[model samples]
Target: MPLSINSIAPDFKAHTTEGMIQFHDWLGDSWCVLFSHPKDFTPVCTTEIGSVAKVKDEFDRRGVKLIGLSVDPVAEHMRWAGDILAATGQSPNFPMIGDPDLRIAKLFGMLPEDATGDSASRTAMDNATARTLFIIGPDKKIKLTVSYPMTTGRNFDEVLRVIDSLQLTARHQLATPANWISGEDVVIVPSVSDETARQRFPGGWESPVPYLRLVGMPS
Candidate 1:
């Protein structure tokens, strides 16, 4: 079965553009965004990778580390980075993992355990399901996951928005409402008792229903 939100993110070691990294060790005490592409040098994947590189600083400020995976080996990954740099004029600011053996892909359940091959012998169609994004929390559990079709480019901005929501909800006792952005009102987590709510939000909240208490973003 594919890994789901709240499940512990499986750890593995792999070669990357920067160097070798052991998944959980790289994540030590920080949130992480681990994204994957079917292969190196694909047009859509190129744009997606460049986009993530552009906003890497935004993720860093939010205490989130960014890592990418592609089924291609290190040499191909290096070659592709040249194309990525030439096309976008933005250097990839984060590591792109070289999963030539599909180890990480299988570990994350992005591919069948039976899937095999180095990028040389395999084509992008062979690993099409590998287009996925994973957000792991400091606790080492997956906070969110999104999988995309080969033709559809992943949205890093929406990913940033989700990170904002996840970080806020983790620190506060409230949940974001539909289309909620930072600075908007938040709903009380169902478990926070009315008595406890009174203690936490001394200013009180707007209760459309007894259970639907809406309050300002936490200080």
Candidate 2:
């Protein structure tokens, strides 16, 4: 079955650029962004990896750990890091999981269980479905998932924005409006009755419509 939001992310043991890791154990108590690429040494993937490396500090500040996956061996990933550095001025600072056998990709629903072949013989198009990203919260449940095509590089800034909304909504009974960013006003979830909302937001809220109550983000 395809994984869904709120489902516990599948765990696996894999070889990474850093070393071997048991996925859930490596995640520990931090939020995590587990992004994958179809193959190593590809141009678009190289830039994507470098982009994450550049803004790694932003993720770190939000208590998010970043890990990458590619359908190639660790040695290949290491070699590709140099090219990534040369092209984008940043090499990946996080562990890059080597999914040469497609085990982790299959477990995470990024590939079919019947998918065949080792990374040695597979082209990027052969593993195209592996271009995916997952955001797992401290509770080990998936909070978000996104998949991009071979031609599109992801926008990590937008990922960060969603993380901000996820963290904020999780803490309070609120839901972010369209294109919401941090410090923007949010809507109280309908589950919170007006009486309860009054107690929660003693400062009051703006009700342009009965079902749409907007309140400033709480400190």
Candidate 3:
């Protein structure tokens, strides 16, 4: 089954580039961005890791710890870390979990069993370790999950943007609009009844459409 939001995220102990780390124990109280790539030393994965390295500080500022996972061994991760530094001139400060046995992958439901008959395969597109992204809250719940094909590169900007939105929403009770961006006006979760709407949103509610109630305010 797919992992559910607002539920405790699956925990695990696995080998990583930085060494062994227990999921909840190591993650501490920080939000987490856990992603998986097809394998180490591939072209697309190389670029993806490089981009994430460049924005490492941004993630740090937002109190989000980044972790990477793949079915490759720790030795492969070490070699790839060298490659990433040589290619990008920056070492990965984050942990790259060495899931050669797919232990952590199975816990997080990263594997698409029916698609690949168990274990994430390098050949499958939607299933397997073919570039999966997950945003887990500090509360240990998964907030969002995204999967992509191995051939295409991930949208780094979108990842950061969504992180910003999620963080902001968590701190303040507000909702992000469609294609919502930082500094853009946020919508308030509306009440079902007209009387409740007036009580909760005293400023007044405008409905451009029946189901669409918008409140323009800073978040």
Candidate 4:
């Protein structure tokens, strides 16, 4: 089954660049972006990790912590991080979990069941990690998830944009519109009862259509 919002993210203990850590313990009091890539020391994964490292400050500003995972060893992570620092002039400030046994990968449903079975000769990733992105809210619930094809790189800008929107809507208790930007007006969720709607939106209630209600623009 696909993971959904409000589901408690599966917890796991794994090796990271900074040593061992339990998932929930590492995420204490901070929102988390738990992302899984197909493998490490590869082309697409290289670019993705570097981009995320570049945006570390933006995520920090929003009180979000990033944790990357894949079925690679701790040694590989150290070498790749060194290479990344040389190439991008920035060191990765986040934890990159080395899940060689697929222990954490399987728990989070990141390892594809049939991916290795279809190969002709040897299966390197029989229990390997898949390229997946999961956004966990501060409440430790899975908020959003994205699974991308191996050929494509994940979009960091889009992720940041969505995070911005989520944080804004969360603080305001209002619903975001079709292409809501930060500081833009938001739509309010109407009540099931007409009287309740009137009570919630008191100033001027006008229903252009049955399902659509227009109140004063948000201040």
Candidate 4: residue 41 Cα off by (Å): 1.2
**What lDDT would each prediction earn against the true structure?**
0.90, 0.94, 0.76, 0.74
- The most accurate candidate by lDDT is 2
Which residue pairs overlap in candidate 1's backbone? none
Q: lDDT tens digits, residues 118-170, model 2?
A: 89988999999999999999999999999999999999999999999998988
Model 4 residue runs over 4 Å out of place are 112-129, 192-210, 213-219
In the predicted model 2, the residue pairs found to clash are: none
Error of 2 at 219 (Å): 1.2
The estimated TM-scores of all candidates read: 0.96, 0.99, 0.84, 0.82
**Worst ten in a row by lDDT for model 1:** 114-123
Where in model 1 is the C-alpha error above 4 Å?
none
| Clash pairs, model 3 backbone | none
Off by over 4 Å in 3: 112-130, 192-206, 217-219
Each model's backbone clash number: 0, 0, 0, 0
How do the residues 1-219 of candidate 1 rate in per-residue lDDT, one tens digit apiece?
A: 679999999988888999998889989999999999999889999998888899898999999999989998888888888999998877788988998888888889999988766678888999999998999999999999989999999888899889999999998888999988888999999999999999999999998887799999986
Taking every candidate in turn, the Cα RMSD to the unseen true structure, in Å, is: 1.1, 0.7, 3.4, 3.8
Query: Arrange candidates by TM-score, highest first: which order?
Result: 2, 1, 3, 4
For residue 154, what is the lDDT in candidate 3? 88
lDDT of 3 by residue, 6-96 (tens): 7678888888888888899988888999988756777777778878989989899888899988667878888898888887777777889
